[model samples]
Target chain A: MDTHDAKKPLPRLTPDNRAFWEGCREHKILLPWCQYCDRPHWPPGPVCPYCFGDDLTWKQSSGRGVISSWVVVHKAWLPAFAADIPYNAVQVELEEGIRLTGNVVGASNKTLRVGLPVEVVFDDVTPEATLPRFKPR
Target chain B: MRDDVAIVGIGQSEFGRYLPISQLGLGAKALQAALTDAQLERKDIDGLSLHMGWPLGADYDRMAEVYGLEVDYVHQSWTHGRFVTSSLQHAVMAVACGMAEVVACITAISFTRELSILGGPGDPEGMREQGATHGENPVYGLTSPAVGAAFALQRYMALYGATSAQLAAVPIALRKHALLSPYAVMKQPLTLEDHQSSRMVVDPLHLFDCSLITDGAAVVLLTSAERARSMPNVPVYVAGMQGVRSGRSEFIFAPPGLGINQQPASPTTPRERDLAVYGRAGIGREAIQGFYTYDAFSPLVLFALERFGFCGPGEGASWVQGGRIELGGELPVNTSGGLLSEAHVCGWNSICEMVRQLRGMAGPRQIAGAEALQWGTCWGDSVIMRR
Candidate 1:
């Protein structure tokens, strides 16, 4: 049983996600836009699933939304998450109408509300990694 | 499709947190087990279907080499949790459509290195570009199926007030059944308190709520039902099959609050649509003997039970609150321990369990020698219940 929860601890950047990370580095949340449907997407994508369009563009976000759902982590299956035992994990529905799941910093399950207003912030868990985390507006 | 394809044999590798087995080795063991169970020589097989799981990239080629057959026909269907039933359906359809006489379908995981915390390992360039559904969900808390299932579990609570004890029943009855299942992992007595105390990967879905990223494999052998009767193992017939999908556009949706109770209903879900997986057998829910479902998430078992007509909508809470899904319950499900107690050999274990029950070899998990078995795939893509 090589259950090595050993942390190699590098956020390797791949080609498809490169531009998205670049946007994050510049403090701009971005999504891929398909020329076919003509709407910006939360997650960067190549083919527009709705219209089957391949042409896409990355667009910036206002980074605003209401908490559609949330849960408090009292436990974790891996050692990477073991230290942050009591954290608030949330599914925030952005103003652009994209719903995403992430951690809400400076809060716990007891304080999370279904409709709490939130804004995005970046936390570099590792030097090579800068992840988007949310907080109370 | 061939109206008479039946599962004549089934087998699985020992499952657990870790094991010293190659994906190919585990697959060969399971394939050999099925061959022995069916009492057929390896030369009898011609068709094959393999789920391209998160194992070694060369699974299909390696399996073909070890099994000593130049596979005549093969199917590669892959996806998340509900993939087990879906994979079996592909194998059956291959046989049904006149592809081959004997077909073996399997899934295997051998290395801890192959497992990905967010999603199964895939071509990075091909994967990250997958859009809102796969892309953003992973970046958020849903990187793992357990986290993805937590989203649904939270909704299950808001809708039916489903309790932790009720949810624990999914793993508890399973572990009890695993006492009889030689291949299952996590079989020790685990209480709701134990589940409550287990580390939570995502709230609502705990460690136990998540299926193991195990190292093992399961294989099933199928042939025309008439041929199966002459064979030694109990003959189980292929009954019905169907597949369902929700929020097909962008993966994320607020699940519009139709009545504005200001809340979302339990997802209408792929498994919820009464698509006819068991309709071909002409057996109703009450007459159906055994049920095997994909349990990538703990809440999915309950979803299948409620959606598949074991109980009415929103009655999942009362359905498995105690020992309802165990051996003596009105319907016994996941007798081979499902994905929770069993290893996560993708969804292959569920197919093997279904065959085991139909053959009356389920031992401790056996449900009074059932004549029929119903198995749901990829939530509800297909339900192949047979007698």
Candidate 2:
């Protein structure tokens, strides 16, 4: 039996979210802004879900924020992340006021609390994707 | 809402990660069980509705085909946000509106696998691919569901003084009931010690506080009160139903509602999120003998109970102390075990439990004199009924 089929490799990229991928590629995190409310959404909506407005724009983000909350995973589920046994996976409330997730590279579990100070930086795991992550101030 | 619609049949299967069976097989099992309990035939169903997970959920045509159900109407519904009883409310409306003789609803999850929280990538081409298609949730390293549901949980704990134990209670209470329920995914009696010992998923929320990705399905059949009264099973009426969509914009805070920056609107003032639901058909909050809010995440449970008016805002943690939410407690919840221990069949099994309580067929775990089992089918809609 081929282990390739047994292990469902995760998705790389698709058309709908290509803009977000492209935004990340250029070293600028992007969010789909509602043309009506002038607000940005993380899981980009097809339409302005708030005002039912059809118009939307992709806006750049500062990629700066504080850690709202985090967890330290002692176990690894797959090959890609196993090397780093204990990592702080966090939900950072970005400066945009939108809560996006990232990993905390420089903190232990006890040090991570509900409202702690932090900032976002990029970790290029692959040649194409410059992933957003955070560290203590 | 009219007092004419009623639930005449209900069914549920064993819960857990059953990668071996397909979703269709679970649906079939539920169909057979419910049909037997109601003493009705598959040919009796006319109108239909089904709600479940992604990819497997987006395909309405496929569900109808696999079940061999020639439904007159159908709706698969949204995410965990969409409650199960909400579908029952619509089916009740269909029966009341003179649409058909009978309506049936089912959920199948035998093959619905879970994604690793470690940013295991995503399904891009599938219709259920949803919005965030392009990148890695892992590179920055925040990928687990505990962390996904953390901000809101933290906010709830901060505001209400809700402890990790209070959060753990939601799952432990359900695990107790699961021992009584053959269909429940967890059978082991989980103590507060067991609850505390479970590894932390996110800060504050331990693994036990989260819901299991179980394999199972549940179905409910409904018809006019007049028709249900004539059926072999006891009659339970559809009392009242209400559902609303807060423009995805209203809840700018994702998951459990945490704003990354300033909220799209002022966060101080409550914007119609509160009192969206009353507890019941008769006595309101005072009369709801049991509660069945979704417990996919413990903090979500706290927020749900508060938002739905079980307690005052930020008072959920305090009110659930010293076995208050346990099986024999005043406002007994998840008496049949909630999604945390019973498996999240997308809250379908919760609706089944409520209906069984009202019909007085919930053998061992049945609440005494439960005239109605008010349920939340979707966060958008709430269901309240009477005997």
Candidate 3:
């Protein structure tokens, strides 16, 4: 197993969201599917935002989305990302109708555009976490 | 509630970095100055309304205790420019309801240690039991408010063909105004070329487009119109004021679900809450002579210009192209250099400028024959002051 020092901020694994992180380790994208509303959402929460129902479950994602908007960070505010200056942070709208935030790995700042088609590519940055990244499809 | 409340005194601390003093010290200095300016002592103040953005280590009760003044009425709004006007409204209502005779509205921000208002690793809201998320963006490398604002700017440019030159003019004009302002932090004059050639913190936004992070505080003294008339400074009446929070729940960086589309569907459209502020004040758009919009980012100026009906949507870039927003222009905007060059104390700096313009105390930067001055945040907080 290959791991690096936790230089950047990392997500803590919790009971309600452990499945999503665990699934990421296996190269599977997971989102919360509410039993009450039958709708999936991102940045998993305790209950359905719309219905507020406790009946919720995990669902696999289709792994496709569009670039709703994006920004190229030329300056790094944190020491961890100093080496990665000039990276792209993008807002991706999944085919499942959920919007997730990630960076597009294979695109330049000049090339990125709104509504650009993108597909998810998981990066096993550390042994404990796998970061989701996007690339032009 | 309209003609009943008037701002009689205004005070501000030096807006650059002040070390060894917490936000409390800065706020107390401004409050004391305001009390003296109003020709009243701390004991005369019975109401306190404060807008101190989050990570606030103290509250209204704490401030009252520190000053040894007992305020009969108190209200607080936490986090950013949107709350400053809301805090002012609370003071107006407090005086109208007889809760307090003299109310003081204070706002302050300290970045001496170089604190970032944008979510950081220390943010409680950014922390989760499983992992830390960067506010709504939730991305590894992107952590500043500029990132979210850049996305909106890109959409605006795509839709209206607004160019960088048009956006650069906003900062350039404001910087020129700052030269005349003795309290301004950025004393150097700025040009359109300097704005265009500056480093890009985020795409479609330059380093100059963002605001100055400094340690400063501003205070406004509000009282009944009858009492204000006796004060030393001329009374600037609060003619019409209103605040509206967006009901849209979907995050800006997040995509809406299939049935749920991202609200405020157009990033640049003037919101209903904006129009309501004008209607509430019973003043038509043409009556406003001076203007100030929250300039946390430069593109926001364009959003506000159109939102307040100063110009049609997509015409803001051209509206400010000539010297229209300068001191001699028909309608002067941000005569105090605003957040870009003046110093960003949330909205306090702008509010103080509006007060000065209406009182004819702005000196060289003063807009002559100014009848009314209006100030608002991009998020819908608004206030109109009449001479």
Candidate 4:
């Protein structure tokens, strides 16, 4: 998993989401929090999605959550992932109450289930891109 | 605008796989058939409500120019199944408002030709700055739209203790209807065992659970109710309409509060707001003799039933069993096979089937005394048509 393949798709970086990606590169999970709403939102945007307020800040998360939903890809829709057939992708409900999509590492696809406790582990797949996967805690 | 506009004509080209015909070519055949069915000339069409566009189907402007349709009013949306109800709603609105004389809701697809875009690298939807609407995160190898449905269904089964065998009833019923449909791409009857043994594309979603990647086109014509009287076919009045819902609680592939994407975990039955289409249509859900939906995946049919209050949350899997949604069941859905067994004309095929059912023209798959039918999706948009 350490070998970086050019074939794997990378998340498109934008001005609004740059910090979250940058935080990931530093091995930390950052979430956008609104000062007015006093809560964090997902897929970070400039304005607070909850209150539509401009007062927003970044905060570190515990990188801990429970699996809310999960799926195993049996088809190689992407050729780069052909070797990883039957691989699992999951939606983890983070401690901050926002969900993020990632893979569950160091676990068998058969054992994955909803409400399973997991913590994030950064995978520095490429020199520039580090994806955050999860493992059973 | 209730009953002010009606679908006077419905037509479609032969549905199949890897057809050599171009998208525009298929569209022309369907358009010609629609014009002939309505006993109207090509020049009568003054508006175009296009649901399919670039990369999958012809653009509105290209369709207008190639088909020689000189229209004034036009509505176009991106190529997605969620837009089918909205696209037809736009046509009804255009005709009711006197914006156009007759609007043609055009949808033509060549999925076999554009196979790469479905989930392959050719699809850039997952790489969008905001993110793909259907939970497509290619970075995690969740590249296809089916994965989104799988994600929702996986959670749904976990929450409700549903099983794969219960979900198989969906494709099995639809395949039964396809056997009676001349236009359906799949002519064979499907069994629960066949569904169980089918290869898995995404976990909890067998290959049969997904829609056909075949090629086809369907065209529908709408005009004012006053003008419909002169048409050759029976007018299927656009009795009621509602738009697609969106918010923090709604997920594109899941019913409200099923907890997919960022949706909250509190699952509830259909609220009053969810049943607005029934009131708008001047009928209750009981009056809806037949049902239709964007069955891109088998799970959508279940979610739609739940979204429309046909059943409570987590009950769709069990509710659809025992010939419940079949042709002569409590409420038949997608009598013309739907996207699952019928060709994926982006759900427009079901729309055509609706018009046919209301007209008493659906030969074998017709619902007895069918008066009202619904075209709703899991996304919460709907259009109800009545005879």
Candidate 5:
């Protein structure tokens, strides 16, 4: 995928989530880790969800996980995706005990299953966006 | 507030697609009918609890203005189906606490006109700064609430060895109920073959598995039990209630611990906290004569059954089979077709059906001596009503 399709919906980066997106742009998966509890939370919240600690750090992840759940959307809910009918979306439980949503490339939709080991692959969909997709390990 | 507040009347507009009437017009029809049913004048309505608002339906201020209702209290939530119970609960609390004398729970939807907001680039909900509550991540083409349900169902099938054939029981039963309902959108009987052969909208979710996108409105009137005694209609008492659950262990479309989104992966049966509504109602789950849930998707019906402990974890697929959830079954659900087969009035249609069942007025779809019914959902909020 190239950086020309401007129709694709991109995540709205914010102060709480900008670091995570910046890390993705650098082809690395960064998670917000609670400095107090030493735990990682998802979606890059301002404070740790578990302990509500304001002191947090962005740590690089292994970008490897097992598919906790997956869905293959058959309908083109978005015109940008109308040509890619039946693409697979998955929730991968990263090794750091958190989950992330992305697509699974380089595999047939039929092959998706719970607990399938996978690793993330970055796709710079646009100049300012690099999506983290997964592939079978 | 068990049995302290009562639903005095229930009314609905004609349910269909692309109705020529505006949302407020549909709301007016239903509100007028509700006032007539309750034998109360519009002046008596001092409170408004609306579950529908901007982008899909009229807001409370607009409804009150257009309907000529001068109210002293108002409760309004975002335009989401999950707030159906919360909206009604607000009405009950308002009336019970004397914040208002008579509260009207109003829901009017125009889904056909607002179809773009359901998904696609036009939908901003999935593209929120922190993601959507229903696991919608549009960046990956995983948009629409249906995709959230599909994600949960696919994982559920893999973990429990359930199949698409077994999931068909939900829509099939609801379709059977719809055939009996005069106001149902889906008139034709749905067979297992139809469900199996329907085109897949998302993996593990056939087109039949999703709820219909249509237009309609429903209204329920609530007042103190003391006032309800003087009304013309039989009062359906608000027996007990619980609010929507949320946390790391909860998913909007799946039972607790089913592990969609950030929910913990450990599978769980219905815990005591989940069954608190029964105890608050001073009744057990066995006394629930019928079940009503937010059946936005067929998998939701199964998840609701499991959420209420009607069946054990992973047992909803098999438990819903063999007409178990149809009328006259072990426990009928959505006796008025629900959102799947009926119009998607944001589950208020089912709430109205519950009132009718409790009043023994549900022609051809009434449960025998229907004394108590439950309006619960996969998300864990519930309101039990009894005659």
Candidate 6:
């Protein structure tokens, strides 16, 4: 592997977050939903973020969302992402009432804008890591 | 504790790179300068509150050893350069409550290298989960501090139809003000065309939109109002100060006034928070002659303008179209060029400038007859300082 490519940071799989990553690896979008509050939270944690309830469940999302905001990063902070300079970083508000950050692939820079509709596409960066990306609907 | 506390002196370390001197050395320099500016002997200080933005600097314990300050009150909290006003509030509370006298509040950043504070996927998951830029931001390449704020600016422009050129005025104007400050990092003039043509770190946020990464430190000496009367220098009273966290989670791309919303927004909005501060101080908007909104990102100036009722929501672009925020304008903000132009000493530089302006000591950039000043962190820390 190229040295810069090797520098990409991978998500550490844990018992609480293993299911979400596994779902992504299988090309499915899974989010943790609080059974107590009946709302979904992104970036899964040990307890329900909203209500602080331990009663949580995972449900598959439709993988559909709209671009609430976005940016084109010209400078690369991490050498691993140097090759991806001038790439688009997008914030997508999923139908599940949560927003996630990812690049808008399969779309040109000029074509990207706020409220752009997109769907998730998982990209396997490493053997153990499959990162989720987004594409124009 | 309103009007009970006052800042007697302010000091700063040389900005930009300081590779030869350690971070502790830089902090000690600022602490000593503050004491000297206040004309207080080393033994006079009985309280200490240290605000370290970057972890590369010395902690409170080590700083005390370096400065030889043994105090009855001591506090050290790591704020991510977002809430230095809260650190000042800590010192004021200590002095007002009689816990200590002659409190020193200092914020120091001692990064000598070109390292960015932007954390990437490599950051501990615990840190990444804190929201703001870290929460759910790793995916979008929201890896850098500038990127998160850039996203917010994009949303604000999209919602309010603000042009990139209008927003560019902020940094350009700040550069103009920076030309007047001896401590400013970028003294060269920044034209609107230059800002527009500059490399885009994140779209709608040009290179000028981002703050400079420099090593610098600023300190403020706080004491009882009664003690301040006897101090050598003109005292800038801490009329009122307030810090509020809206929620545990922070959202970088959220719209203005809504970004970084803490849960239960009873007093989280800037207007509410400003009113709270002004009410406590028994002052109003008419009394404020200087405003120093955090300029970590220029778009924040727009947010502060609207939040403080300087302009209506979505009217910030038009409000600052000309040199409205420049010196001699309606309300001069960040007269020290703020984080954008002056050394990014967190918000301490703003407080320092406010004190000097009130004391009629800020050369060239001083706003004459400046009686009242307001400065704060973008994440909801408001302070009212008066002459």
DockQ, per-model, please? 0.24, 0.25, 0.44, 0.91, 0.86, 0.48
Q: Which residue pairs in candidate 6 collide?
A: A101-B140, A102-B140, B132-B250, B246-B262, B246-B263, B247-B262, B247-B263
User: How many clashes in candidate 3?
Assistant: 5
lDDT of 6 at B290: 78
Scanning candidate 1 chain B in windows of ten residues, the lowest lDDT window is B252-261
Separately for all candidates shown, the number of backbone clashes (residues 3 or more apart, or on different chains) is: 11, 15, 5, 0, 0, 7
Which structure among the candidates has the greatest lDDT?
4
Candidate 5 residue spans exceeding 4 A from truth = A1-4
Which is the winner by TM-score between candidate 5 and candidate 6?
A: 5
* Second chain TM-score for model 6: 0.91
Interface RMSD of each: 6.0, 5.0, 3.7, 0.6, 0.9, 3.3
Model 2: per-residue lDDT, tens digit, B1-387? Answer: 446888888887766684566777777888889999889887788877767645454356776677676767765664433446566667877888788778887777643464532234442222245623212243433344444456556655654467887777667777878788767868789989988998865556677877776778888888888888889888778776666444433332222233322224222222344433452244465777777766677666655565565666566677777777777888788777877887778777777888888878778988889885566521335677678
Query: What TM-score applies to chain A of candidate 4?
Result: 0.96
Candidates' lDDT values, in order?
A: 0.65, 0.65, 0.76, 0.91, 0.90, 0.76
**Candidate 2's residue-wise lDDT over A1-137, tens digit each?**
01122232332456546687677767778888887799976666577656878688888888777776555655454344555555566667777777776667666666776567777666544556556667778
lDDT of 1 at A103: 66
Off by over 4 Å in 1: A1-41, A47-62, A72-86, A121-132, B52-58, B77-80, B111-127, B131-143, B244-274, B309-314
Candidate 4: list runs displaced more than 4 Å: none
lDDT of 5 by residue, B63-176 (tens): 888889899999998779789889999999998888999999998888899887688776777867667878888888877999899999999999999999999999999999
Give the worst 10-residue stretch by lDDT in candidate 5 chain A. Answer: A1-10
| Candidate number that wins on DockQ, 3 or 4 | 4
Candidate 4 or 2, higher lDDT: 4
Pairs that collide in candidate 4 are: none
Q: What's candidate 6's DockQ score?
A: 0.48
Best by DockQ: 4
- Sorted on TM-score, best first, the list reads 4, 5, 6, 3, 2, 1
TM-score for candidate 5, please give it.
0.99
Q: Which ten residues in a row have the lowest lDDT in candidate 2 chain A?
A: A1-10
* TM-score against truth, every candidate: 0.81, 0.82, 0.90, 0.99, 0.99, 0.92
